[model samples]
Target: MTAHLSRRTLLGIAGAGAGAYLLSACGSDEPSTPDGPQTINWWHIQNTEPMLPVWAAIAKEYETAHPNVKVVIQPLENEAFKAKLTTATQAGSPPDLFQSWGGGVLKQQVDAGLVKDITADVQPWIGSLLPASVQPFTIDGKIYGVPFDVGMVGFWYNKDLFVKAGVTATPTTWAELLTTVSTIKGKGIVPMALAGKEKWPGHFYWAYLAMRIGGLGALQQAAKDNNFDTPDFIAAGQRLKELVDLQPFQKGFLGAEYGSPDGQAATMGNGGAALELMGQWAPSVQASSSTSKKGLGDKLGYFAFPAVDGGKGTVAEAFGGGNGFVVGKDAPASTTDFLKVLLDAANQRKSAATGAVLPTVKDAADAIKDPNSKVVAASLASATGFQLFLDQAYPPAVGQQVNDSVAELIAGSKTPEQIVKDITKVAKSQ
Candidate 1:
């Protein structure tokens, strides 16, 4: 996930401690080039190792087109990237171009005048992307960033496990999902791979559950009013709690550190765990491993998060958005040119062909050769609405609080009601 900034100003101040890490990550790079050839610094959180080839291809294409411009790519882990971007922006040395999630986070930086308005620059390509991919990044009617690949977070189940448990189809309702998990558990296989130690991953359950229980209108209203104490919010927390007692998660998953290939490979390959309510990012894990779970592809079955049986919400409600580029205030004009070169139809196609991304540029989805990539593209296009990653949308303090509350729920120390109350309190305070 990426957040964009203008020049170097950030208005919504996180606590003092948060600023320290940001400062270090955004540390000034030596002025590598200035007059002869413009060099732009690009930071992103596309951490997949396989994606390295795609990035290299992009760099090569851009360099060929813009002979005088150079793009230095810096790929960081998600949290670390966010922290560094924040620190660099605060300290006045932000990168020329960076990747960011678009929504409230982008809005915050926009309000701070930390990011440039690229709407005019990208207008020619606006008609290319699926309309939904552009919606989340649009603020007050202007788009702040380009939409790259759009993805959804939901349940991915192992077909082999489902067959062993005598389940023939994916569950379409919350009740059915629960029943499926219970049946899988009875068959001696853990039914879900929930990661609690990495709180953001834990937060996804609450986010999707809240959408399922409250409906998109309700969730949006709550976000607008910062009203997490509402009954619907409590209901979401309660739903997550129910799953914890079901003990459907893999053993030690509550303590699993996310982004660790070892963790996912171990649980899915050897452990009798059947499903993971994770983002599209999970597939790369299986694909990268040498274990039996590797190369799952379509065998990695998926279903949209189900509606709470008979609830106001529909099964189509999903969490989704894209990872794309943003220019910094301090960047040279060549940086924008460089981005354009990299995002050209051919280069975008190359990225899709490599299977590391779905293009942010219009018509780029057609270049995707991998069957699973096509499936992911179709799923993204059909989504009803997308939420930027929840924690990413919340201000730091509030996001951290929401994260901790989920952890406590998993620990059995907080009820959904209490969790909602805490979140509402922080939302109001903001």
Candidate 2:
């Protein structure tokens, strides 16, 4: 079905923020013959190896199978694509299919009438995907996107350092985690590595803390109410303060970049720090950023963010995001069908085997060959609730305020109460 979005929708998205949606991969459905020759304009951020050729080959085959369709694919780098998409959306024209990371951005697109409500188109095969992975794209009970890849953020620790500190187990509670950090520090080892200068990574701690203490529903409620100044949110800041007060990071953490020579990943990779809070890409980035170009080897281990003493959330609730594609409101009917081809279970398996994705298709989990990827895939498979990153989940202004306020909180410049107030002000304005 064709949809029209007015120019006012562009202002709504810009003044508000951005959005993205995902797709599920599974059912074997062939493209329906179109009424006439149609061109599908597609854009994605997988502008690199392995996936680049994989997508090209898939498109070529799809074209060979359906001569009436011409798939014009434009693979752009991450930032470049974001800029282009912004320009396209502002012009009331988005690529027929493009990358998305389902959150407030996707919601705005839907509200602005820029994205398709593909619930009916995908319903038959959607069940093949993991439920939690689809949580981000389900707005007002309608599916706008489908998730092909999903993952979560957690504590990636150095096992040898844990053993060196005489710690026998991973921390299961907030208190236990604090004790672990202190214990690790007592041995003169850095407890954690963080990119303090980069606000996004630091926000993960606050988001996870909010999730653990206030529950995923609390976040959703806060977003809807335009209020983040709740007791639970305040308590979340207090809890984060408890950990920050311990001064667990490396010496120059406040100025460190995420992937630089002396950055968070490199520190973790070189065994200079005991732990880091990162997403599924931690291992590869660590290795690539390390001096030796090989990270901790078998010494690396991962665990979900620890639970709190009397929290409403559980370790089962995840916090992270991954790649997905959204169909433009004006996209051809075949776009969704072509999306089906892209996300078919077999294709998902191939993507999974590439070690770059945690395919959201549940039945495709066995295709994950890397042990670490398998771990994350399994977690997504059983995830009870999933929250996208706060920066992406909220309107850009609100999300950036979260990152800013949390960074201030961590930097000792903002109090728990003040950060909540700051975030609430921005949320209300949004």
For model 1, residues 336-389, the per-residue Cα lDDT tens digits are: 556666677877787677655666565677887766556667777776655655
Q: Write the per-residue lDDT of candidate 2 for residues 1-430, one digit (tens) a residue.
A: 0000110011101111112223344444444557688899999767777677888988999989888899999988666777899899988898899878777888888888899988878877788888777877877777787767777888999999999999999999999999999999999999999988877889889999999999888988888888989999999999999999999999989999787889998999999999999888788778878999999878999988999989999999888877788899899878898888888989988887776777888888889876776787778777778888888788778888988999999999999999999999988877
| Candidate 1 lDDT | 0.67
Weakest 10 consecutive residues, lDDT, candidate 1? 15-24
lDDT of each: 0.67, 0.81
Candidate 2 collision pairs? 18-105, 19-105, 19-106, 20-106, 22-145, 22-146, 22-147, 23-146, 23-147
lDDT of 2 at 117: 82
